[model samples]
Target: MIDSDLPLLNLRDICKSYGSTPVLNGVSLALNGGQTLALTGESGSGKSTLLHLAAGLDQPSDGSVHLDGEDIGRLDDAGRAQIRRDRIGLIFQQFNLVPSLNVAANVALQAQMANRFDAAFTAEISDRLGLSDLGARYPEQLSGGQQQRVAIARALAPRPELILADEPTGNLDEETGDIVLTLLLELVAETGAALMMVTHSPRLAQRLSREVHLSRGQLAVQ
Candidate 1:
């Protein structure tokens, strides 16, 4: 069970550097359950790097990240992978769906890995995203907007505690992006999950509950 007293996701004094070039320096933040936070910055401001660290795809040079009140830095690669599979949902600009899998299979993939697969749930999300009719289509067969919705559905199918999105709408047109963002906001709200989205658009950032700007490897409230 999650500890009620702890924030859903917390990062303290996070610092990451590749040899002599520092990407993040002393960055700290916390996200509570059901809260939506927007991360905005110019390119190369370490936004994606921060997301990667939080998602356990990378590690910090210093400090700790706690998810479900457990310190992830202490865990080995396999242990961290377990936490990620069971607790986090990731959506990326690239819409990383498997080419061989059909839509339905793609949405069910993560939940299957986490041992939480439910056909009903996957179908429900796909329907909500207007992808029920496209269940048999491959990722390559879909348009940009359709592909993004599919990514969102796949990330959200498992009902994770946190959602990490890195430029989730970067590849879409404005109208399509708006539709996708609206769906993401509404669905994530219904699931009561925390969202930390990285975007370059201040307009989109304003739509979230809170916004933070990352500049020069540091974060400042905006």
Candidate 2:
């Protein structure tokens, strides 16, 4: 039986390797609903690798990853894909958007894919992200900040319980980054979703509820 109160995302004794080269070794962490956690580390410390494992984008060599109390490692690729489409939201530094789609279509893409599209919620999020007037514009016509906002709207449009973000504000200038980070946190709180963000800035890490540092592929003390 699964516990309803279990952490939304859980990792136990996770390890990853490339051939014989170990990346993460015996790493464990948990993230509960509505909580925010920051993953921080130097380059090659496996921060992004850990995030990838959490998102089911990659598998670990050893250990278990549970999302909403279900063992993600046990799922097939299609199952994992479904989980991503229905339960998890992802934000990336590169602002992955479809160049051919206008802002409205891009924001609604994930929700439509899951067959859980909510028109009211989509409209609300569009306004909240300040994308209401850009509905007809394609990705190439938007500023970097606007593109990232569209990504944010797309992620949240599904109302996912867990959001995994990889250096979401890394490409922005400090001022824009601050604004976007603040908006991300606010939206996460509003939706009561747990956020696990991979960031290189200690200053940004402090804004999250908890910070986990990876040192030599191992989690340092909280």
Candidate 3:
């Protein structure tokens, strides 16, 4: 069981730098269970860098990151990879579907990697995402919208506690983007997972609970 008092994801006084150049400074944020937040900032404002830290893909130069009560900054590479594979779901603007795998295989990839594959849950999410009929299709055979849905299905297959999305609809047309965003939000709500999405558009950011903006590597008012 999860501790209700602790946030699902937490970052404290985060700082990141490459050599002498700093990308983030004294950044701190928290994401509680079942809450959605929009991470917005201009290019090079450390939005993606912050996301990478939260996802355990990279370490902060200073401060700590915690997910589900585990301090990620202290975990080694293998441990961090496990956290991502088992506890968090990620969606990217590029979709990032496996080119060699069929739709079903791609959707089941993470669960299989985590050794917690569930055929029924995979099937349910696939159907819910309208990918049931396209299970046999490969990534190259699908449209941009379809591919993004596949990416989402792949992310949610493992029943992750937190979902991180980076410009999830950036590649689609306005109509398609709206449709995809609606479906993503609905599915996220159903799963009761905390979401932190990075988007540049205010319209899209407003779709989440609240906004966190960055200015010159520092947090700004919502």
* Highest lDDT against the true fold, candidate: 2
Q: Which ten residues in a row have the lowest lDDT in candidate 3?
A: 179-188
> Model 3 clash pairs?
none
Q: Candidate 2 residues 92-136, lDDT tens each?
A: 777879999999999999999988799999998788767899999
Clashes of each: 0, 0, 0
lDDT of 3 at 155: 89
**TM-score, per-candidate, Cα-based:** 0.92, 0.91, 0.90
| lDDT per model vs. reference | 0.87, 0.88, 0.87
Q: What stretches of model 2 exceed 4 Å from their correct place?
A: 1-3
The TM-score that candidate 2 achieves is 0.91
User: Any idea what lDDT model 3 has?
Assistant: 0.87
| Best prediction by TM-score | 1
Worst 10 residues of 2 by lDDT: 1-10
Q: What is the model-wide C-alpha lDDT for candidate 2?
A: 0.88
Candidate 1 Cα errors over 4 Å, as ranges: none
